[model samples]
Target: MGRSRVALKFNLGRGVLLAPLIFLTIFYFYPLVSILSVSLFPAGRIDLSGFSEIATSAYYHRIVWFTIRQAIISTVLTILLALPCAYLFARYRFPGRSILLALTTLPFVLPPVVVAIAFTSLIGRGGLLNRLLMSQLGLSSPPLQFEQTFAIIIIVHVFYNFSIALRMMTGFWMNQSRRIEEAARVMGAHGWRLWWTIYLPILRPVIAASGILVFIFTFTSFGVILILGGVRFATIEVEIYRQTTSIFNLPLAAALSLLQIAIMTAMMLAYTRLQRNLPLELQATRHTLQNLSTRRAYTLIILLVSFIAMMIFTPLLALVVRSFMSSTSGTFSLRFYKMLTVNTRSSILFVPPVDAIINSVKFAFITTLLASVLGMMAAYLLARRGVFFARWIDPLFMLPLATSAVTLGFGFIIALDEPPLNLRTSPMLIPIAHTLVALPFVVRSLLPALRRIPPNIPEAARMLGASPVSVWWLVELPLMLRSLVVGAVFAFTISMGEFGASLFIARPETPTLPVAIFRLFSRPGAESAGQALALSVILMGVSFVSFLVIERLRTPGTGEF
Candidate 1:
């Protein structure tokens, strides 16, 4: 009878795992299968025309080459630029370190569209600097001329991904035994010599993980390229968006998406494997941190910190400045912000701009709930021991992250039209779509926390007359609360700023903030641009609050993300 009961309990545990699996199957794989079906076998017949065109066309070859070339450049430059700064963060106990680190990370979470808006306010033809130059130098035309340039694209890409390199490397570096640096110095090794022999090998795994993750992010960049790079530059993601919307070529769009997925999947798989090898041991950062006593060290810290602030914060500052500047004059005004409440568009479907904020908040709450619940379940499943499918299952949760948001959005439109899942038109699909994108992040945030909980704690509770459910509720849940809140905050932030998928699926009347800002920018006028900037500022503020929460709660230098 005891054997039968154990067997029954085992079956029940296994049965519980099916919840997340079923959700994944229904939402993730099914949409992907729809894309695959449409791309390869459109109109109930096999179709290779799109693939053939891609292979034969020189234009596409340029697009493909440019995408690869730019992503490579961005990743290499981000690492080169961020590594030294990360060294400071890893080694120093400095003033405002927590706030500075939080701000540095703030960019990575800000929507790409917001980043683009911020840059436009800083350097675009009608930007603050241009206007200042025009007034001071008596110039009729903007002198910066930085618009749509290759250099600007690279600059923004580096800006967006710099935090990933900084945070990841700093976290890994903090845990390294300081004795290694000491021993290397004792051998008369200095600077590059020390790096080559000691630091390079020690930091290689983290560098690889950071580089590959940033590479994937840059490779699939859509919003920055679309807004700042303009029509001249197009990544695969941008091209996918173009093909689907402007060209109305579903097959071609699907083909580009497939090509993108193939590349991203290979990179994500490499990252996952690398992540598995990253040191999981948590060491207190205080042991490695030191006071900066040397004048030279202080000078370097000040210079680097200033540069980071200039790079990361200036654009956002300019965004705020631009949003307040009156459209008709250079004087400050709140008209643009007030314009959010006014419907300037001459259409029945257009709602007040403020509704977008309300919708975003509402959808974000739903997404936070759904994603947190599913992510916790998924994390638990992945954290389980002795499962044969563990290796494959971990990557499956991550595939959504690797997949293009454009493709995912398009897949939803086509795949969810039938009964029992005919949610293509429903507002609930917005949160559901958001849940898919946010799930990976939510899972990643929780997994580290979950794994850190010792098995004996729960076992001890059970041994002390606690039921299985009670053990989890009373003992395990409290330990996980911080991580769970972090994950939920991630979900809320990502959902609030989500642009790509929301662009494709968001209803005309119920646009999210990013979608609303994008729509506003599509029209040409000072009023439109000002309102867009204003909305972007609001969105950035939301991200800032979320960042503060993460900075407060996250285990310093030990975050899995």
Candidate 2:
């Protein structure tokens, strides 16, 4: 009876793998195969003709170089800028620490429109800072124009990815045993010497893990580059978009997509390997946290807090203020909010922003449900030691995240071209695309919680005559409630903010909020800008709500999240 029960549990864990595998095969792998077929194997014949064109083209080479170069620069800058704050977070406990830590996850959920509008409100030509400078100095031209520059792109990439480094490093640092540090101090090793000798080596794994995540994000980055980069710069993602939309070269677009996938898959394999080597030994971090011991310590804490506040929160505040202010009268008003309800011109694409909000919420609900179910199952399956295939399958699940949504969308167009699979025009395609994008995040968030569960408890429950279902539902589910909420919140917010794939898949009349914001921002005139800012503010509110949920429910010492 006992041996049979153990077999049942193993079978249950192995069975959990089937859902994620099937979902990936249909939505992820099938789309890739279809695009490759259409692009390189048209009429069942191999085609290197398109390859020659891209190879000989100087512009394509520059794009490939630019993609890798920017990602490397962005990853390095984010690590440098975030490490001090990570140390402060790991070593010290202070007022507003919870809130500050929560802020780290906010950027991941926020729409690109909000970040773009926030930066514009703070530093653009007519931005508050530039306005103040121009008025004080009586200058004819605005001094702070960063609309299409390389520096601004780097800054935004840093702004978006800084949290990845801080969160991962802080978590890893917190869980570390400080025996080495204590011994080093006793031997008179101090400051830079101590850090260079002991700390850097210990942190090498997590640093590489977080750096790879940032690199992958910036490597295939689409929305940020398109919104801020202009014609001066283009990544591989942007080049694919232009080739598909402007040049109508599907074959070249497919080739680029394949290249991105190959590189990203290799990097993801490395990340997963590093993740396994990461220390999982949990200890109470409160015991490790120190109070302000010296004047210099207090100064360092204050400086770190201030920098985080300025870098992360100031632009959001600026965006909120800008949204409320009227463009024409330059006074506090609700004109832009009112503009969302009006469609006087009766344009075919002019769905009211209100409807866009409704559409986003509706689709987000479906995405949250689907992604949570698949992600939770995948996490649970991997947490089981009996499942050997989980090792290879785990990294494969992350490929959806590494590949650009543009490539995925292109794949969808080619793959679902037949009847019954003809989901290309269906409204359900919106949520389907969103679920593909949001699934990896859900899996990442919940996997830690699943792994943190003690093995002894399950064995005890089984001995007490509890079935595997009872052991999970009555015991494990409650323990995982917080992580479950975090995962769902991430899925919902990601779906709400998704742009690149949504732009490709969403019908003109059924636009999502991000799509609407892009439309409004693209047009000239103060009214359009005002409307875009207002819509951006709405999206920002959703991100804040996600942040609060995560902050309230977070349990540390689980993993290097």
Candidate 3:
């Protein structure tokens, strides 16, 4: 009886792994493998010709170089800008500090298409700054020409990723032992010497981790490069899209996808190794914000805060302003918003613009449900099990995160077109793709909460004659509710904003908000452009509300992406 009970428990534990494993295999790995096989076995025989073509081409070489170079520059700039903000957040507290921290994370969740539109309204040829300069200086043409330049790409990348560095570094800094700094001070180290010797060395691992994450994100950039860079610039992601959609060259697209996967895998491995080497530090006993005691400190704090507020809000503000202002009338009105509900006979979209919001909400709701369940299972398998397989399974869950969504979307187009697995035209594909992107976040959030539950508590419940399900319901569920809510919110917001994958799979009649916005922006008309901005604002509002609710419900000291 004892042996039978032990075997039953073991099987139950392993059973939780099955759902996520099967889901990833059929939806994620199968699609990727299909793409690779098509590239290598073009004529039903193995060939290296596709890769050879990419190797010998100078155009491809420049693209590869540009991708790395831009990512490096973006990473460096983001870190430099984020360090001061990280220091401020770690060492001081001010009024509305929590609110400010929450706001800083807004850009991170906004769709790339929304971000591109926001920046264009801020600095593009007909953008606010350019128009102001042209009118004020009496120039025939707009000045501050930043669009389609390397500078704009770097700027946008920094805007999107600055929060990652700030949050990670600040969280790490707050938990650090202050004893080392005090010891160094007593040994006569001060100012630059103290910082250079003490803080930099300690912060190295976290810095590397943050940099690697940012690099990986920027390396797979799609919407930002395509919309902002225009025809002149093409990252690996942009090229892949072009090869697949415009040029009808699936072999080349497949080759590029393989290369992208290889590079991302290498970076992820480095990140894992560095994470292992990160020094464990005790949580601070108490966290309190310091008041500014010196004039210089007060001045610096005010200036920095103001600048950060401007950087974060200006573009979004421009988007809102442009959405309301009529280009033809040169005045503010509710015309663009009203147009959303009015179906036009000549419009490219088959349905009214507001319908896209309905579609997006439906997709987000389904994705949240699916990701939460799968992620909870994965988290339980990792945190509750003592099995050796859990070690490898943890990283497998993160592989979808590292792979580019554009690449995954492309794979879906090719891989799911025929046979028993044909899901290319299915409405379910959009939610499935979004869930893959959101699963990592769900696992990350739930894993920490699960680990915090002491084993003895569950054992005590069992000793009291409670069944496994009863113990979970009576003891574990309430404790994990906050984390579950956070994960669900993240999944919902990510799905709502997801663009790259949705672009490929979303049917015109049932377009999600991002896809609708992209189509609107691509067309040549002032009304369509204004409608795009209005839709973007709505998308941003949805994400913001979700995040605020998550913030209120989150467990204190739980880290967020």
Query: Which number leads on lDDT?
Result: 1
Judged by whole-model lDDT over C-alpha atoms, candidate 2 comes out at 0.85
TM-score: model 3 vs. ground truth: 0.95
Tens-place lDDT digits, model 2, residues 442-488 = 88888888887899988799879888789989999998889888888
- Of candidate 2, the 10-residue stretch with the lowest lDDT total is 279-288
Q: What residue pairs are clashing in model 2?
A: none
lDDT of 1 at 249: 92
Tens digit of per-residue lDDT, candidate 1, span 145-236: 88899999999999999988998898888878767778889989998999899888888989999999899889988888888888899999
Pairs that collide in candidate 1 are: none
Q: Runs in model 1 with CA error above 4 Å?
A: 1-5, 280-288
| Angstrom error at residue 314, model 1 | 0.7
Q: List the global CA lDDT of all models.
A: 0.86, 0.85, 0.86
RMSD of each: 1.8, 1.9, 2.0
Count of clashing pairs, candidate 1: 0
For model 2, the stretches where C-alpha displacement exceeds 4 angstroms are 1-7, 280-286
Per-residue CA lDDT of candidate 3, range 1-561, in tens? 679769978787767879999999999999999889989987899988879989999999999999999999999999888877887877776766676777777788887889999999988888998989888899999878888888899999999999888877887777676788889999999989987999888788888988998999999999899988989899999999999999988888999999999999888778755643442442444355578888867886787679777888899889989998988876999888998976544756567789999999999999999999999999899786466777667778888878999999998998899998899889999999999999988987887688778899999998888888898899998889899999999999999999999998998789999998998888787888888999999998888788777767776445435
Q: In candidate 3, residue 270 scores what lDDT?
A: 80
